[model samples]
Structures are given as structure tokens and as C-alpha cells.
Target: MRIIGRALAAMVLLVTAAVAGAVEEDGYELWMRYRPLDKAAQSALQPRATALVYSGTASPTAQAAISELQRGFGGMLGKVPAADTQLRNGAIVLATPASMPELAKGLEALGSEGYQLRSTVVQGKKLTVIAANSDKGLLYGAFALLRAVGTGAKLDALNTSSAPKLQLRLLNHWDNLDRTVERGYAGESIWDWWRLPDIRDRRYTDYARANASLGINGTVLNNVNSKPEILTAPWIAKAAAVADVLRPYGIKVYLSARWSTPLELKETKTADPLAPEVAEWWTRKADEIYRAIPDFGGFLVKANSEGQPGPQDYHRSHADGANMLARAVAPYKGIVMWRAFVYAHEKPVDRARQAYDEFKPLDGTFLPNVMVQVKNGAIDFQPREPFHPLFGAMPKTPLMMEFQITKEYLGFSTHMAYLGAMYEETLREDTQQKPGGFTVAQVLEDKDHGQRLTGMAGVANIGSERNWSGSHFDQANWYAYGRLAWDPQASARELAREWAAQTFTPDPRVTGPVVDMMMLSREAVVNYMTPIGLHHLMGTGHHHGPAPWVDSLGRPDWNPVYYHKADRQGVGFDRTATGSDALAQYAAPIARQYADPRTTPAKYLLWFHHLPWDYAMPSGRTLWAEMIAHYDQGVGEAKDLRARWEKLKPFIDARRHEDTANLLDVQVKEAQWWRDACIAYFQSVSGKALPQGVKAPARTLDYYKSLHFPYAPGRG
Candidate 1:
């Protein structure tokens, strides 16, 4: 009897081990993996997905949606749902008023690109239906349905619909012609430019599919630092070929135009916006591009920012440059996205106040088809920034929000910082405009005036890396950015949970801890690298690692010391009225609220006010002690993220699990490095001893300051 019991116990142990072992995968599929669910979920979903019934004309968009459904069902339920002409029990239907008039009642309210998914009964047979106003909507609906199934949502109770709030959802690829990506931590550029026009890579279709799944309908194929030759004939053919691959998936291709392209081409003497020859050259170029691409999206111009040439070179306003391009594309119904990130010519009193000072007065000057694209922050893309003042300041203009998906300021790709929290923070900021305050998200959706254009642009993190984004976890930022761009009001925490379920496994044991880790990761980075509103303290050129003592740069603003202003007295930038008065750029309510350091949120204390080291914090500790505690807490959190991932090993495939584990190892070291180096540098400046119970930095300030990484990835 004892021998028989031992044999049964061993059999149970073997079965348990098999259940925990997921198949090896390299994370190439991203959230679209659609791997088979657990037994209970598979059993519950299989019956509802017995057949696909769509009698509508299979347009390219429709065909794409149908193919995705088949792929998702085949992967998830172990069989591709058969296509049937007649509706049957357990069938999934794609419907429009033209295809199935009976099921199109609620679809009208869901605009052209919106969709509705519901479980309904037809002739006493229960089935699922994805109804939309157009084929594009059906495509988006199909992706939403797959997301539901992958996340293990109940099929019987499926009833949800979505419409993108913003009109233009785009990925801005800062990829150069030579294939090097600016601020791209992921491998080389995804566009195989050298071989593009003739030998199209299968990856292009996959890229379109990925973007379409998230409702991202546009992509700028080159770097914002535009080259003149891209407008030449040879490059137009390459762009047209890529655009063909993307068009069927409802995506349009946009190009970044060099302001001085005509001058460089020797077609015009001066690149001045008002000059007839310059205008004529652009018009002719636009006509040439449209002839090749036809459905091309308009240009994204980074004029007068950095060293990029613009109408500013001719002493003309930004409106003059943007309007010239707008007129060129207007005949083709294309819109111009004029970037509002202007600086670097002459040092301003406060760099944070530059864009608002320049743009606020010209709010009503831009043409209807032109959108002033503003970055999320007043400054560059810091880890945490107050929403750009232009959001509230320019009610007359249609402003588009630009978010950096690339981790330029946050630790580049390897660090486990989930940026959904950062995006959510900026989106949820109260602009505090007169009459009634509006959140930054609300500001983007505003249409009180006759304005029509509304959008959100994310700087692309995608590359030739097999995983798309450099690290496994970094892909979540790309996913979250797309989801948020669709609906700015969406919750970051919920988005993280959804991403966790689809990317890894739907099992609670895997998703719960993973989401927790993601939610904590961004804050962990902020705490270690730039806690309590400390901004832009990274090394000069590469923008990697810590270099708080870097003060040798030619321009004052180029140095980390210029921003932090750490001395023997205090650390932090002072934007108060007494200092730079950058805070005055906000609405009066916000300015009044942030005018006093004590009333300011601790998260943004140092951004607006500079205080003494011994100043009392709300935590009952001196400012010095609180800063030390935050650094210590961040190091512990980084370690905790690794430990959490370790526990999730059983639920994930071996390759992906190990990749994340290895990256987490790197994250812990980097987080520790950032903590130790910053604390060392700050302590030296403050002349303060280590606070009680806080560990001293492992190295001296000189040791950290002496270290340099000249060959860091992602440098321009």
C-alpha cells in the first residue's frame, strides 16, 4: 500500500511541473503572442469561437482584420475558426450596416474609426459580433476582441466599444538615412533604407500590423532632423514602397522636411518662407511626393530647434514657416505638424519659459490644417515634468501632445522603467485655466473653437531588435503609449495590467506581481535618478548615467550643474517668481498654488522652489534626510523588482524569463549606480554627513565624477 501511494504522489508532482513549464519564446510577437490560455480559460473560450462569419466585401482592411482573428484564434484555441457564409451558433460576426443591417443600430454613434463588440443571438443562435461604421473600424474591433480573449475576459459577457479620441495617432521615428537612430536604444533603424524600394522586408508588414492593432494610423519614417535628399526622386520611391505596405492596414506615411531643402537642392537662392521661389519649390516637391504616395500624410517639421534651419534664419516667425508648408500640402488635404520645441540660438532667461513666450502670442495665427506639436514638458523629456504650459495657454490653436517613447532621459532601454505612469502623470495634470480647470488630457480634446485637428505623437522606440523595443519590459511603454494616445483618459495602472496579461500569461499569479512591478518601476527610477523634482542631471552628450558635476559645457544650459544648481547651500532648480519665474507660465491658480514651497507637491518641490538642506519636510525629516531616504528606498525597490520577476519564472517561457531576469540584474546595478553617484555628488556639494540609518555611498564623489562612457548607446 505504501509503494502504491508513493507512485501516485510522484505522478502528481510530474504533472504539476509540466503545468508550470511554459514553452520557450524570444518575445518577438509582443502582446500579440496569443499563446494558449490555461485549461479552464481555453475550455470556456473554445465553444464561443467555433466559426467566423462575415459576408461583407473583404477589403484590404477587412481582410487584414479577418486574418488577425484567424491568427489569434488559432494560437489561443488550438484551431483556426472556420469561415462560414451563413451565421451559426458560436460564430463571431463582423458587421456593418451595409453587411448586416439587423446588427448596426448602435454603430452610427461610433464614428468612422470606432467599433462595437457584443454577444448577441441571431435566429435563436447565440454568437459574438464586431460591428462598425467602416472597414477600418472593423479592423480596430478585431484587435480589441483578440485583446479581450488574450486577457481571459468572459466571452459570453463581451460588450464593449471604443473610438479614438484623438484624430492622428502617430509614431515619430527619429531614424537617419544611414540607419542610426537618434535616442533609440533599440538596435539599428527598422527601415532597411538601402534596400527599401525593391526588396521589401516582411518586417514592414508586421510593423504595420502591430501599429494598426493599437490604432496608430500614421508613421514618420525618418528623423525629425531632416535631410534634403529625402525629398529627391530616389527617396520618394522608397517611401512610396513602404507606404504601400502600410496603407492596407489604414496607416499613412509622413516625412520630416528639411526647411532648407530647396536651397540645398539649388532650386532656390534663399529658403525664406515668404519668398515666391521657396514656396514654388515646396509646392512642386509636394506635388511630386503625392504623385508617388497618393495617400501620404503631411510633413512633421522640427524647424528652428537645435540647429535645424527654418524661417527663423530669415528673421521670420514660426507661423511663416509652418504656413508655407501648410499651403504646399493643403491642395493634397495633408496637414502640417509644426514642432514647438524651439531654443538653442540665444540663451533665454529661463529655458522652461521659452516655448510659451514664443508661441502664446501667435496662438491664433496658424492655419486650420496646421497643429503646433508641443512636447509634454516645458523643458525636454525629463523623467517627470509638469504638463507643458502651451496646453492651457493656447486655447485658440489646435495643439498636439508629443511624448517621447524612447527612454532618452530615463535610464536607456535596459532599466525597468514603465513610462505609462509618467504619461499618466502628465496627462492628468490640472492646467488650472480660467473659468474651469482642465487636465492636460482635456486640453488636447478641446474643440470649443472651430478647431478640428487633435492628436498625440510618441517618439518611436521601435528598431531592428527582434523584441522591437530593446528590453522585454520596454515594449510595455510602446504598448501603453498607443493605448493612451487612443484614449487619454485611460488609467495607466489598468493599461499595465492588460499589457502584463497579454505579454506574459493571463494567470493571476503572473500578472498581479508583474503589474505591481511595472507600476513601481517608473517611480523607482525617479526616486534614484531625479527625486523630488530634480531634472536633467544626466551626463552631457549621451544623456546616460549620472554626471551632476558636469559644468564644463560651452552653453550654461547644456551642463547638468545649470539645472540642479547644487552648491554648499542647496540643491534643485528654482523656478519661483523670486528665481526664474518659470512658474508664472502656468495659470494664475497653479502659479499661486506652487508659489509657496510648503504648499507645493513634494513630487514637484524642487522644480519650482529651492530650499536649504536642513529645511523641514512634510515627512518630519530634514530635506537632506528625506533625499537620502528616497535614494535608499529606490535601491531597495529596484532589488524588489528583480525578486518579483524571479517568482514569475515558472509562469513564463525560459528565454523571455531569463532575458528579463538578466535585464533586471542590469537594472539593479544601474539603479544602485545612479543612487550612489548622485548621493555622493550631492553630499559633497552640501557638506553633509550620511543621515541616520542610511548607508553611505560606496564611492567618493571624485571616483564617480572621473568615470565616463564615451561610447554609450543612443547618442546622436
Candidate 2:
């Protein structure tokens, strides 16, 4: 019996070791895995590491910090550091100033959730100190140190203190309950709603780890075009289970609320915000949600837009609807994120002016718990767009910028488009409304009494794909979103380098070329797909491939022809004062710049003004010639990206390298397709001759127009 017991113990030990070994190999663990480094890097890291000592009682957050330290140390150094209850020589101490009076004196200058990591000696002992205002801050500090080490930075004199600029950094998943994600690529919805409360997938825990590492604090699990069924008792329980897993990582879960939920789910007669009975119904629903998940983040509502029912259905304004939900969740300290992407499909007026027209008047009327969520652009997430008019228009309302991390318009995951540039471009645009420094970042980082309660949300592109997002490079966009959300002021270029180092390797041979490729990627896509401000030119419904000629769809706004209005003599939409007067929506300085085609940036020329084919461009070429050159340039760049990546074959892994190589090949082919197809169709309408050195389309305009894509991958 003793020999049998010894054999069992040996078996258990072997199994544990095997499982840990396997986890180390899986790249799915992302940056948080903290696997041990190669010999050279490990040698650089070992001298700085000695013993782990934490100064606080074991709270969940503190335990999380300890667990991360253990995991990172074990993987990076091949051994976990021994934990000491007290600080000593060659020891690493994790503590808040309040927890250690001596350390508190040193940490007096640190900000909230900020930490100071310094090499110091106390009582003839050398130590590395991780001091913060709270244990959560310490955890963040530890992660930052690990990141620095991972990127092969020198560990000596590691004095660093950091805090998130934004309080709420969230990802909004546009996933439906039926597992059909709207504009979602990669795979079906990740939320396993049917089996959730009873069965928790380990993937949920991994998702939490990835998010926590990037300082993303919240996630909205469902689509903004929400279903009322998600608010039912059974679904609430399922959400609570997800919230439970996320809670440990300091992430709160939010739900998207359907405006007519009371009417559809509860059988209420009316869903009016002004109605007492409707208000009562919402309070009850809020209570039910809080009962199941005590720390539930509040609702995200997409009201009166895109055929979704809203308070406007009952003649109530958006503020009325948002305030009603805010009142219901105010007691629980929850917030209401009301989407401002509203426009009447039936309205023939400028789509760019609609959101501003609707919400700008209601400023300051919303409750403190309510935040008006505005998309980065006034129009849909186009390949390129001017800053939304609402950024500076609503001074009294807390505007939370919504950026689509998903590749809905930018060729899904097939074309390489780095959205970090897109995000940064929109945020850094000087609204030029306020007399002094008033960037979009300033509006979002607005504070009350030195306390920043601002928010930023990105529509997630993540799914159940092996690499998380569909393509390998798509992962960088996710990383970029989190970093930017934490600090809106962060440079996309700097973050690109950091992400490349962590994701691929610290080798400049690999990272330098990759960063160069990423920097120009978004512009390359824009040039090929919708260069010079041409928008909504993709095929109807699924939005895959080029179909600038698509004029027939269910609704007028649904057709590509409704947007670009190309004809016999010219192309491009006319949004100038003489046309839709959409230019009037922006500040006078910006409006004047956009209203005149001569002054408008050549990249956004077609967006703000209609132009004749004879229009002279800054490049000493006609609009027709320059437009053709851009398309040809885009195709050339795609080919160059493929060639550059192929050259890095020796540095990158065979599987990922080959995968990216294949995707780049597809990108080149499709870029040519967009060029040939768009030029062919435009020539058919405009009757223009091809410029010198330009090749004519292989297929006729009709052939390109007749092409059908009834079964595209992400059509659901």
C-alpha cells in the first residue's frame, strides 16, 4: 500500500510538469504567459531578480499580483522567486504606502493607481521596491516591469510609475445571442450562452488575462443592436457566471440594452421613458441584473437608429431614454453608454450631419451616469473620414469615442490595415473649437475635481480563432486599441514597435521591417479601396470586395451608388456648402478648409466636395490621373509588403510567416481587382481614356459588375 501511494504521488507530479510544459509552448497565452527567456535574455534578467516580498494581506487583487509574479518569474527565469514576508537584502518588495509606513513616505508623490519601482537599500540590505496606492496598482506596476523585461530592456535603475489616463477602457462586442455576429470575421460569437451558467470555458479566463494585461477594465458581451431576450432571468444568470470569471481580473461586464426591452420581453404596452410604468419596469430589470451580478456595469443603448427601436418610437428624445436607464442604475454606481450613431434611413440629407444634428442640442440634459458614445467618424467606419462633428459640438456632454477595432470596412481580415493609425489620427485631430489646446483626447480626458471619469470603447475584432483575431497582424490592432485606450496620448508608432517586440521578437531585424509595414498599411488599404474620400464602395450587405458600381440594394443608403454619385463627366460626393452643406457641421476653420476643393487635403478631396475629372491635383495631375495612380500605387505597395515579409522568412516562424505571406498574396490580388474593377466601371461611366503607362482592365466593366458574392465568409 505504501509503494502504491508513492507511485500515485509520482504520477501526479509528472502530469503537473507535463501540463505546465505544454502551456509554455502555446502562444495563445499571449503576452501574459511570461515564459522563460532564451539564455542570453535570461542572463540579463537574473541579476536583478532575488526574492519576492509583498507588504499587504492577501486580497484577491494582491493574490493576482503574486500569482502574476510567480508565473512571470517561473517562465522567464525557469524558477519562481521565493516569497518573503518581510523586506530584506536582495529582496523584491510589493507594498502600498499605507501598508508600509516607511514605504508610504517614499510614495507620497505617486498618483492614484500609480506605482514606483526603484532599487533601494534599507538596514544594510538591497531591495527592489514596488510601491503603490493600492494592490491593484502594484499588479499593474509588476506587469509593466515584466513587459519591459520581455522587450529586452535593461532592468538596472528601474524607477517607473504609471497610471491609466482613462478610467473606463472597454471593448464592445457586436455579437448576437444566436452566435451570428454582425460584421464579425474570424468565427462565430465567443459567448456560449446556452451552457454558460453550468459550464465555464477556460477560454474566458484566458480572455480576462489578455485584457487585464493591457489595462482594459470592461467588456460589453453583446451587440449594441441588442435583443430583449438577453435581459431575461436565464441570460442574466449566464452573464453573472461570465462576470464572476472576469471579476477576479478587476474587469466588470456590461450588457447592450434594447430600447424596447420592456415592451418586447415584459409585455409592457409602451417603452416610453416618460411613462411611469415603463420606468418602473426598467428599475425592476436593473434590480434583477444586480441581484445576479452585483458588480454589473450598466447598459449600452443604440437608440433610434438603423431600424432599432428607441425612445424616439414613443416621441421621447435620446436624453430621456438614457436618463431613465441611468436613474435605474444610479443607486448601484453603474453608467449608461448611449450610442450617437443615429440617422434616419429615409432621410435623403447628408448622413454626416445627422448625428450632430440629433445629439448636439441635448447637451447637459443627460444624467451624470450617462455618457454619449460617438463613433470616431460621423459616417460609418469608412477607410478614411474627417473627425466627427460631435467631438467639439457637445461641450456639456461626456463624449466617449467609439472606434471599430474590427475590420468591417477595411477589407475584413484579408487586407493588412493597421487601425492604430486610424485611431490616433481621429483622436489627435485638432477640433480647433476651443481657443487653446483642445484635442479630442482633451475632451475625453475631461475631469471633475481632479478626478478623471472619462471613457473610451473599441468594437472588438476578437473571436474563437486560434490567433484570436483572424489574421496574425490583426492581433496588433487589438493590442494598439488597449494601449491607446489606457493613454490616449500614446503614439501609435511607439505602440507599434512595442507590440511587434512583444508579439514577434525584440530583434530589430524583424521588428523594424514589420513596423514599417504596419505604419503604411492603413493608407495602403485606403488608396486601393476608397482613395480620395470615396466611401461605401464595397459590395452590398456582406461588404466584401470592390463593387463601386453597385447601385441597386434594398434601401437607398444601402447602395454604393447613393454615396459616390459617379457619372459621365465626374465622380465623388458633394458635401460642400453648395451641396449637402455637411461642411457646416464642423468648426468654421475646418469647414472652410473642407468646403473648398482647392484647400481640402487631396486625400479627403472627394469626401467634402464633388470634383470634375479635369480638376487639377497638388501632384500636377488631373483627378482622373491621380486617382488611377493611387490605385496602382496601392497594388504596388501590397506586392512590396509581400516581398518584404518573404525576406524575413529566416527570422519568423514557418507557420505564421507562411500564413502572412499567403494573406499578402491575397491582398495583392484583391488590390489589383479593386483597381481594375473600379477603373473599369468608372471609365464606362466617365468615358475617359487610360493615361500613358496605365494598363486597361482585362475584363469589361460589365464583367466586373456581374461578379457575385452570395456566400462571403462574414455575411451573418
lDDT of each: 0.90, 0.85
Model 2 TM-score?
0.94
User: Highest TM-score, which number?
Assistant: 1
Q: What are the per-residue Cα lDDT tens digits for candidate 1 across 283-359?
A: 99999999999999999999887878999899999999999999999999999999999877385577888888889
TM-score of each candidate structure, all chains considered together: 0.96, 0.94
RMSD, candidate 1, Å: 3.8
Q: lDDT tens string, model 2, 321-346? A: 99999999999999999999998877
Backbone Cα, N, C clashes tallied per candidate:
0, 3
Task: Give the clash count for model 1.
Answer: 0
Report the Cα lDDT for candidate 1: 0.90
